[model samples]
Target: METLRNEIQQLKAARTVNVKKDVQALRATHAGMEAKVLKGEKDLNTLRNEVAQSAEKAEKALETGALVLSVLSTPGGQKRKMNEIS
Candidate 1:
């Protein structure tokens, strides 16, 4: 009976150590995943800003094109355009 008790204690201690190691590994993995999530969010924000800037630039280009077309439809503006081209 004494020998059986000692064996049981040793097994319990080994299991405790293994559980602690598993917890540490899980914690490290969670931390790494959190860092990756943060970086992904930052990248998404950067992409959103780029998309907004591109949309603004496209809108400005469309406005400028419309203004040019309106101006070209006028007789005086057409004469000026011809003069500039020459």
Candidate 2:
């Protein structure tokens, strides 16, 4: 009976060691993945900013084109009418 108890205790100790190692490994992996995701978010934000800037430039270019067109379409400095049917 004493021998059986000792065997059980040893088995439990081995299992505890294995569980601890597994938990450590999982934590390390989770931390690495977290770092990678943060980096990706930073890159995504940079890309989004670049796209926003490009859109702003495009809007400005279109506004300039409209201004030039209005100047050309006017007569004697009259305000140009919009082509909309409303």
Candidate 3:
């Protein structure tokens, strides 16, 4: 019975040590994932800002193109543009 008790105690101690190691590994993994998530959020925000700026620039370009087209549609304006080009 004494031998059996000693064997049980040793097994329990080994199991406890394994559990502690597993906990540490899990915590480290969790921290790494959290950092990745933060970086991903920052990247997403940067992309969104870039897209907005690009859209604004495209809108301005379209407005300018429309104005040029309207100006060219007039007869006097066409002559003026041709003269300027020459």
**Candidate 3 residue lDDT tens string, 1-86:** 99999999999999999999999999999999999999999999999999999999999999999999999998799998989999
Please list all clashing residue pairs in model 2, or write none if there are none: none
- Residue pairs clashing in model 3 are none
| Root-mean-square deviation per candidate | 1.4, 6.3, 1.1
Q: Model 2 lDDT vs. the true structure?
A: 0.89
- Which residue pairs show collisions in model 1? none
TM-score, model 3 to reference? 0.92
How accurate locally is residue 69 in candidate 1, as Cα lDDT from 0 to 100? 95
Q: Count the backbone clashes (under 3 Å) in each candidate.
A: 0, 0, 0
Q: Which regions in candidate 1 have their CA more than 4 angstroms from the true location?
A: 75-77
TM for candidate 2 is 0.74
Candidate 3 wrong stretches, greater than 4 Å: none
- Whichever of 1 and 2 has more TM-score, that candidate is 1
Model 2 RMSD, rounded to 1 decimal: 6.3
Alpha carbon lDDT at 59, candidate 3 = 100
lDDT, candidate 2, 6-35, per-residue tens:
999999999999999999999999999999
How far in Å is the alpha carbon of 10 misplaced in model 2? 1.6
Q: What is the TM-score of each candidate against the true structure?
A: 0.88, 0.74, 0.92
TM-score-best of 2 and 3: 3
Candidate 3 local lDDT, residue 47? 100
